[model samples]
Target: MNAREVMLTIPVVLAPDDTVAAAVHKASASDLDILPVADATGRFLGAVSKADLVRHAHDPDARVGQLDSADILVCHPDHPLERLDHDPMSSVPHRTVVVVDEHGRLCGMVPWVNWAVDEARTQSGHPRSPMEVRTLSMHLHWRCLDCGYLSARAEGTPVRCPHCGAEQSAFALHTED
Candidate 1:
């Protein structure tokens, strides 16, 4: 699957004119350590990180663009995740890679953890599980019959439901379509 297909679509974005304090607030609210910075035209500019904001805490009034890192890794939506390689020389340790469109507009963010998971899954010789394949293809949702807890993840039924602690048999797959 492509990076776009698995990327987080609703990423927290910071505007270039926004303040360092604003970036910190947004990052904290979103539980993200880093946030993508975009221009007024919705074009991807760079990223502001929690560490950077903390480093510039004395200057909270500074614009995010002034403190944002321009050396962020960016990939196209259609880029193959398998072909992505980590750059050891990256200026900032990246938790997520920015995904942009042909026009350089921000689309989504792909977390490194997702890539690690995919790599492990592939190396296990199990390929993609039926639930994973179905969810990726059809965007199916898995529901816990015992507690009615729903999840969009396609990793198949867990040994126990996260919500009700019910057995794996309590989970059923359903699609909105």
Candidate 2:
């Protein structure tokens, strides 16, 4: 299957001009790890992730430009999603990859977990099959928006944090492993 077929639609996105704090808030509220950065024309610029934002705690003046990686790893909407891992070093450290159309417009964001699954399936010659790596797991640091609690999880969405009655949307998900 191609990226268009497997890629999840672009979730919440933040503009390049948006402050790091705003990105953090939106990400936290949406329970997402990375926030796609776009231009005024909605062009896919780069990505500002939860990690990048947290790094800002040490420096609030940090702009998206400072934390954003201009080297965006993108795949054509028509390109096979399984091809994402064709190059072992193609992907960046923690930033979610952006999917662009022929015109280079931001179409979607492929999280690392989804990308890993696609890559693994392709490598195993079962691109359309379900996950076979039984021990496959990932860890992430999440911030609870409602109660401002910071916690960690292993691959499942966290809802109804103890400190607050908020739902999953009340937390921001950031991959740490």
Candidate 3:
């Protein structure tokens, strides 16, 4: 599967200008230790770790924009998870990957589990569908608000609109009574 298929929408995000205190509050709502940072128009900037937020929590005025972003891992939506040419995440402490659209807008976050799955698949020389490769055990049907595309995704987690590349806010669970 491609990065887009395996990536998950990071529900909580920080704007570059957000204060360190505010970032700490936002990060608390998420299960991930690292949070993606995006701009007003949804362009990806970087990420701030939970530890970084805590370290700077004493300085509420400190802007998240000041956080060093040189080590963030970046990849396109269509990038194949099966193989990567340049995986700088090998050295990145967070090791989380940020998936971006063609215009460099934030698409979603790829958990390290995907890489582990790839490793097993490669070792076994077995090819499986995205669902088979995914670690999430549950899924639900969803529809993109920006476009009419509908599909199933891991339950409760958001995802980038595969068809129109709309951000997570534009998606809604679809159910029929």
Predictions in order: lDDT: 0.63, 0.62, 0.66
Structural similarity to truth (TM-score) of each candidate: 0.60, 0.68, 0.62
For model 1, residues 103-144, the per-residue Cα lDDT tens digits are 999998865533433554576564754322222335346655
lDDT value, candidate 1, whole model: 0.63
Instruction: Give me candidate 1's TM-score against the actual structure.
Output: 0.60
User: How displaced is residue 96 in candidate 2, in Å?
Assistant: 3.2
Task: Give the top-scoring candidate (lDDT).
Answer: 3
Note each model's CA RMSD in angstroms: 12.1, 4.9, 12.2
lDDT of 2: 0.62
Clashing residue pairs in candidate 3 (N, C-alpha, C atoms within 3 angstroms): none
Q: In what order do the candidates fall by TM-score, top score first?
A: 2, 3, 1
Q: Compared with the true structure, what per-residue lDDT tens digits does model 3 show for residues 152-171?
A: 65545356777899777555
User: Which numbered prediction scores highest in TM-score against the true structure?
Assistant: 2
Regions more than 4 Å wrong, model 1: 68-71, 87-95, 113-177
Clashing pairs in 1: none
